[model samples]
Target: MPTTNKKKQKKSSDTAVQGTNDSSVVSKVSAASRGYFRDAFLQHFVCKVARRAPLINRGYYVRWRAVDHCVRRFLHITQKCPKKQILSLGAGFDSLYFRLHADGALDGAVVFELDFPDVARRKAALIGSNITLMGMLDACSPPAAGPVSISSSRYRLLGLDVREESQVEDALGAAGLDWTAPTLILSEVVLTYMETQRSDAVIGWAAKLLPQALFVMYEQIHPHDPFGRVMQEHFLKLNSTLHALRQYPDTSAQRHRFLQKGWEQCACLDMNHFYEGLVPEEERARVERLEPFDEHEEWHLKCSHYFILTASRGSLLEQALLAPTAGPICGPHRGPAALGVRPTSACLEGLGMASARVRPDQVLLTGGSSRGGRGAEARALIRAQEGWRSVGVEPSVDLDVRLHHSATPLPGGGVVIYGGRSSPLSPTPGLFKVTFDPCGSPAAPDSERAEAAKVRVEQMVCSGDPPPPRWRHTASVVSHTGRDFLFVFGGKNQSEPALGDGCFLSLDQQLWMKIPVEGAAPVARHSHSACSYQGGVLVFGGLSGGGRPLGDTAVLRPTDGGFCWGRIDVRPPPVPRYSHCAHVVGGKLVVVGGVWTHSDGVPGVVVIDVSTRSSVEFSLDTTAVPWPLMLHSFCSELLDPEEPELLLMGGGGNCFSFGTHMNPRPVTVDLKPALGAGFPSWS
Candidate 1:
């Protein structure tokens, strides 16, 4: 009786862990039901599960979006090609197959989901019990008696211990998975729970079986960080060990694992940067406004610990999968869209101003001077398919000579520009508004631009106490408590050291509230690249108060009522520099040309993984990047989501010579090849 009781207790413990795994699916369904995001088929799988808490819903929403993005990319790549297969390892109760089928994105694709026997049997029972799920399957072959395995033309569900090599192989064979065909294997937070050897075997098995395939995995990384320690503790409390995390704690290690296991290319990015930069901005905005949220710090901390890693081989998987321009398949715009026009000449002296995309086809550029030491009054209208063109300055608008200001895009289709240096040593405190009228007259030729004006700039006065006058500060638009607020972070105030303070401007109330941070705040700096990442703002390399360049990075997260700052310590940090440009691609902070203390002045590009806090510096090939690439206004376009290209406009001179090459032609840097193979030993 004692032995039996012990066995029963062990079984109960195992069941609890399994339940926790299944609960994730329930959370996703609950989130979808609450309108956090749409997943019509998820409801059928969950079958009236209890709604998750708002925080859980948001986490699931982010997870769903990341996984969905990867799945959609796979589907888009295999759309026109021969029938491909997708294998979901430890799929649990995931409704991906049903969802994809419902959206008609699963055409010519076979899906196979594998999990432990107990979990799979329960899922099989659930499907068998549900007529709707059963009906969705084609004329499928009946499973062998008691074992729950369904095999169909398009979908297959199998129950097996994935750790058993023979069992996994047998299950795949029985499910009719074409090993030789192009395939995409998904392991979402699955392998981390398995022993290191077991997960390695699973990866090795897949690599050996699929000649042309892309393996995508979403799992926890950076287990040594403070947030990661909390994550570890939570899993430990749940009696589930993150077995593989210790072995591959960082993205670099994960990349190395894939490379060692025969994958030709591997790319990994944390959910924070991936969600912010890779996910569609429109989709992010829609889901962000779904629920009232104020846990900005928690959201970023959680996302920073989780990452998506993709490993690929073969040209088909390499070129097609994760390409940004791969548009809607099997629809009106079924094929790839034409690459848009590239900017030739942009302001070289706009060292710290904001550029907002006001329309799908247009971007507004304001507050920058020309290389000839003249403040630019005529705002530039960068149109799609057309190069940069000047918008005639309105005589009614009293524009000030401001540099280092921030321009934040409003939800109602406008931009709020605030805080910049009015003179060489003074900072301005007022805010400026720019609104566009699409119904206005078409833009006339360059000669008639003065008479035919369209865009308008208005200066506004606020009611609340504004922040101190500062320049080179960063501003990001974030949603808080069902309202949009503009968050401004560190910059230098005139005659004062770089200010580490931050504040938020409530657009509706026209109120400015200070964000009192609790943790270690970053040192005051200017000319830093601050971008909206996850639920907060990520500030990268900047110039310190003593006219010294800084290479540290920090993030400002909104806590329960106030805010907190966390500084990320990167190993072998990028050279201390300022007046540089940074862009987020996947999970990396790509730092472009900046003035370093070194003699070269313009060092090569630096790529830092925001997740693991590891960095790799790549010196630009003189043949590829034009020489003397300092102070250039760098912009990145996701021509392909998997591989983004960088464009450098203007700015090419040392500290001794200000704007020698004033109107430098744009230099396009194809980063795809560099990203693949981990930017290996660039000359």
Candidate 2:
């Protein structure tokens, strides 16, 4: 590269990297404003304060929480020492020093923050101008010529490029940093912006200089998955690419990197592990209850791609190491080993749509928001001589707008649709009955059925009590007194954390009916799966009230008098997941793709043999799928009762700030290999 061009590129890169600091402080302010954390200083750094989406707020909260955890741990362990210090790399408008001082946690520790010269000057100016901020600092002198931007007894802000080791060392020495003290070095989403070689050199330099230091870092990882790819692209577009993601891609790799960089003891965990195992449960629930959040898929995916690590050289800091509060996650990441999928031309795609087989050859899909907005018309996927094709149908009556609804196939015929909301604030009321019929005779040719499928949708008005307006619930046909009833359970509304009470609607009368039940009920949840099993329904997996994924399985069986709930234990329990689809065929519960907190990849097929209480998992090979097959907030159904083929359609969510990813077309998953040869055909 030419010298002139190299210099220009470097200048542009530095500007772009520094620009990230502006956005970071704004998000932190948003998070703190929403009670996710307590930070009075961040608001002063931003020009204007604005509210962020719940997902973004939660993301920043975890980042803030992780750093606080490290800081507190380090302070407690080194409290007895006469003098200790904290060195924050790329601190960029962070108020950690002020926050610690206000909390009185900085009794004996001094905090040194380093960033670019421009950023340091900006931060120093903000501090000098604000009366609230000025009160926190001991007498400080204005920044002038050298690397030291702000000088105070407890806080020293420096402007030095971390890539230049000798300059940083000399600057720290001049700032009165104690080299041999029990120092805590913090780097949150930093160091990844530079070239790999530069970042590695920085890490090595810190380890060599501070023998009794604890290095803390929080940054992105797992750069190969769909979410990861989007995250990488988001940064690349900003002209600040993440350099560490490819090499230090996971917790294990990150741990090894620090160890190889001359750190003696190190521990690393993805944010999901930190949030679950390390943070207290009550506090998590409190944060969750602050806002009405429905973006479980994005929250978990965002957490899995970031990590918190602590590395120590001396034994004093070893006690501050991050350790898991619980055991290892159950089941291997199942197989992303690529289960074969047959390509299909089914064009129907949208999240929160409901799918059910109205006939052996016809599947009805209704009521979901699409790129064009909430679909007013219904669609039917009919099997033809060539293949399954989706055809538009005009319903007899408007079902209105529905998202995260349920479509239950009736034993006698027709379908029952219930419980969905157009948006978080508007849950559709009452019941809907949708029936699909072939255009011609009952024995019409497959080609003709594919040409023009007819659908009828009607709102069913009933006399008995109906469940309150809600979405993300499950509805299934369970038999009682030789009559099938639409059993509805587990969902959330705008105000409730989650709805646990189950209600039964008689299919024969279209009236909400009550039947006797026994045993403990499942916890309040939403976005789970329930399928008909032996005249009852088997429910599995959902998001709990505390915003955690659930993996327990239970059966509501038909006793002579009513239904009874009983737990079903499967060895090597499937990893807890939510926002996925499920179906029962030949006594096996086959769970399809969904979002999980497992560190590396999305989940695949988890087939639980309900009869034997055994389970197996398989991964989806979307090699032929058109786009990234995000399978959550989508719908799936068995194309044929006798075959192991399933169709997944209409998923994708707002991927944090990366962008919205919606599966463009329907994809087929062939589960023959996942379910071995001897499986009996579905009758």
Candidate 3:
């Protein structure tokens, strides 16, 4: 239900008989598809959970914290020192202004939230006259900027569509905007809901309206790899609940357009890389506690989707960030693809490798597997590559085989290895961690390499209480209360004989708590995929008991100390599939193909809208899909469109078939538009 009418005028051509026919047909098809996907994602998220849970809370905490980071950066960039006029476009239910004001990060700053009349009304009721809300009012329907008094400050709320150039100008005039002063504008998970042209117009207006302003925004970008395809699909499926889900196929290109329109600077970082930089010091010990999985050590790469960008009236702050100061990144990351190098299918798209990390010059890796007879030889081939080398961590040569998934570099010179699934009957959960650092690089000397390998174990924490253990369970790092927070979503639960509940760990507090969410949470499941977009977690498609499939989607948001849950409304693709991979590139969730069932099946891929919660089915034609089934073994990473070869190692898929035991094999899938060459570029 609720809806907002986009401003679109009928063209004279529409009156032509032939043009009318074509338009009518297109509208019918689009509407039908939108409904299907919206309901489908909602089934997964809301239909299943009735009450808030820890998983949902943690997911919200993760996304909200990310938004908070962007907000602060915007303030610093525009205000020239973190003090200035701030506006939240389409404020929705955003509580950042309130939270930040309460915490003192922005006690004296003038804050304004603009949204639809209804949303603004609800937000006012939820937090009224609470000092933070002193100058806050619903501007969704404001005829003009109306003045309000907050302490000694005077502010006004302007209800106008950013898409309308004249309206924006009027609102700016009414708000007493001074072009000479720096301003910070934030549009979080909002633009993707509008058409590309409209989104572009909004960006264009912002660049031209203010003299020195920074516009920090988050939106969906299309993926260009196999894992990306899978990630895109699940997102569409989960978002099918809302009818107006819009996907931005080219977020980077859009950024360029913003620059062309007048933004002086722009920069973006994928989710994994962003979190790696935000984690605090204490978490470094938690990351170093476990050893790298045998399999994880072999398949080394980082997989993440969401992208954060900061554009301003001045040059973007590209080279000013401090170097890694915390610990090693969790998954394996070879710094951004070397400059000027084009990528292959193995590489992903949408990740601006260069700006995402510190010291992107180094090739990062986690682990891989040895095929029969090809054991040493295969590894030799990998090592021989000009920019490739085996990860330094060793597997536990004893029991419990290790499967390396990915690694993330920490602020401090350390690496956090996340991969490995403990056996079902094993005492602990499937998740594991490892660290390697503080030693010179392998190029330093043999002794240095050995010293690096001899890393000291710090802190190890595991449990079946809050969030049970499960391989491939999605995790994201958030900053809150001056510390890094780790939030985990759905995955298999070896201890509970089912998928575990979601959990979050506070590095500063040294505390781990289960996320309490309402509405609906996914059923006890495993191998499900999750990505955070728009201040919420989008989880779709997974495996349940009896080998049944799950195509529903659930979203978790933070409320008080617990979490709130809401199911997405999306329509399943031609078939209901699970074990697929999901990633958030740009602002959309990309879900790539995976086993349709326990038995043989084909790759199923789709894309979900994070804002409106709708799905768009993309038909991809490929050679015979991978043999055997992959469960809890698939991973995906964001890629820059220009370079196709820099694929982040998605996790590995395991086969339980009773055949010649086979080690994990790395597979690369290409995403091409089925029936067509590729997705249509944004208008």
Candidate 4:
């Protein structure tokens, strides 16, 4: 009777241990699922990396590369196949199916995932609870309540204990998995938890089920090594055992296990080799620089103890799995180039200003402050090459220091500088003509070209009374009545409120005439953006008289002699801000950074479709910029019309401090695929 009691006690102890192990496995899966979200939030991955620990983020990255490489290889090899399928064992809460669907890779593929009952149920609940995740799945039919298994058009989630061969077969059958299709089986650090015999049985079962399949496994190895021992001990302390690691001790043993278990061919590689050799160098560099890292020793040790093993039944599958091992199949492409800083002897600064591309490789920059000083009445010629170089800084004008000025490029050549603040308490209402003579005689012997580049600035004597002295206005040169006219609109005079008036200075007649409008005019505002578009001027976002940021948009259509104003209703308008930069590109208004209140508003680029009244915002990688301010003067030029590479230059930093000055270099943003052209490139 005592012996019988001992047997009962032993059985009870074993059952308790089993229950604890099951809980630990689920806990580990939960932790990894959380890690994915954390990594995404932090931007560790191109998709997302929220706020994950650096070590965990980096580790996850390595794991992602291994899995992605195998999947990509499978897809590449089976491109000609009519049907392709992927089965993931112990899938946990992975979002691979959704990610692939987003990438458009799941169009002709079937994805099936199997996990323990609890883990599968929890993952399904999480997905069902979140609208974002649920929307990714093909919701042809309503999901069942409290479902432990779910099926979509291209994805299926099922629950089954991988150790139980019968249950695994039943789940696959119920999920309608195609065993005859070219299949890729993924087992990431899952089989390590099962007994060696159970793992082997699972492997053998897959090999027999799928005649043309590639089984890729990622898990720990070399449990007897010093580093491996530490890893094993860590898992042991977590109440989890590396049961399969002792059986497949290293990559060689792993390969042998696969080949001996009915796999026609097998290949194995440690994570260290996989990372340094198989992963593209460019991709590695990009993620490596995402955050500051100093865990070389730990990284190498951890990677060295893990291995990626691929076993295949068919020659095509074997070749596909081994092809990437030779080298990276897909290397990273070069991002947009910075093209170096804008060459300037001194920094150009101001709140509202102008920059225009007058020549193919040159832009004329005028009327901005230098360092902490007020706007210097000077013009700089910027030449674009491998790097931007200030080819010449013309002599400073004798005119008063000006800020919030307008420099409109003439149709013939040269620029007309209009009303601006001459001093803190004064406004310069007079128009100034600045011309550069490329063929003029030499003044000095520095060089023949340098001597020929002569600049002449002179104040214009108009025929009629000009508009009252005002600053923070917009000016654009438009063709009106068979001649060019400089149109100025909406600004503030000293001690006055914002003005809603508009006027045109006829270059041919040398006469300033008041612009009579027929329709509703834009509200009185300053620091708004205006660009000539389709024989009209499009005005957007500015600061109102009450110092409020305004998001109103209007257009001034050229009439027989004067102008007609019409307001535009934009859906999902951009954030209200002033001193933002805007340019007409591809029938859309591309608005860059701006200032809101006392802070930098949106640092991303906002593209608005004028015809459709729709808008989309693309956030800039903050790491790419020197500062976080929006009131900087910037000039953009579309270099490639087909690819549409827009190069943006000269923007001030977050603050007005001496250190947070304008950036000298140019940053290129590609407007391809997003704009229905191609993918964006940034340098």
Best by TM-score: 2
The global C-alpha lDDT for each of the candidates, from Candidate 1 onward, is 0.66, 0.85, 0.43, 0.65
- lDDT comparison, 3 vs 4, better candidate: 4
Candidates ranked by lDDT: 2, 1, 4, 3
lDDT of 4 at 308: 84
Name model 3 segments beyond 4 Å from true.
Answer: 1-59, 74-83, 129-158, 224-255, 281-303, 315-683
Model 1 lDDT per residue over 161-181, tens place? 777888788768866778888
Candidate 4 lDDT trough over 10 residues, lowest sum = 37-46
Stretches of model 1 off by over 4 angstroms after superposition: 1-16, 146-148, 320-683
What tens-digit string does per-residue lDDT give for candidate 2 at 1-683? 99999999999999999999999899899999999999988999999998998999999999999989989999999889999999999999999999999999998899999999999999988988999999888978776589898999999999989888999999999889999999999998889998888988988899999999999999999988778877898899999999998888888988898999999999888888899988899999889888878778899999999999998988787784588786777654353345776667666667778888776667788888777555535887776656667777777787888888988877778888888887777788868788887665435555566455667778788879778888999988888878888888999999886889899988778788778899888898998998888988899999888778899998999998898999988766788999999988887899998888887477888888877777777877877764667889888888766677888877887888687777777778988777662322231
Task: List TM-scores for all candidates, in order.
Answer: 0.50, 0.93, 0.41, 0.45
**Across residues 1-683, which tens digit of lDDT does each residue of candidate 4 receive?**
69999778645533443444344333333334444322121111122223444455566677777888789878888988989899998776666787787777765888998877766777777777766677878843544443237888788887666777887786677667887889999998788777689889989998998999999999887675334555666667555577888777877789899988899998888776687667776666656555543223245446657788888987667584644444322211222321222233333343334566655545556665655555644444444233344445474466566666777778888878787775535786568887765452223332444455666778788987777788778888776667777888897776655888778888988898765668988889887888887667899988776445677678888788667889777756666667677778767887665544211213356667777776665655535444332324455555555666565655553220013244545566656533652232222
Supply candidate 1's per-residue lDDT for 515. Answer: 52
Sort by TM-score, best first.
Answer: 2, 1, 4, 3
TM-score of 4: 0.45
> RMSD in Å for candidate 4, one decimal?
20.9
**lDDT of candidate 3 over 1-683, digit per residue (tens):** 22332212222211221122222223323322332111111121111223222222222233444566666665554444434677778655444554565455563467765654444444444444344354443332323224221112323444444556676676566555665556677876566545567777788877777766777765434344333344445434433111112333443565576688788776655443444466453442333222222121111111133455677784434332223333432221111121221122222111101111113323333333333312111011021223433334443322133332223434444433443343333323233333433245435543344345433334345433444445545565544334454566655433432454666665445467555556666676655666654445667776664334566777766655566778766543323456566666655566765544211123444666555555555533333434222222434444443332223332332111111222133333343231122233331
> lDDT at 175 for candidate 4?
64
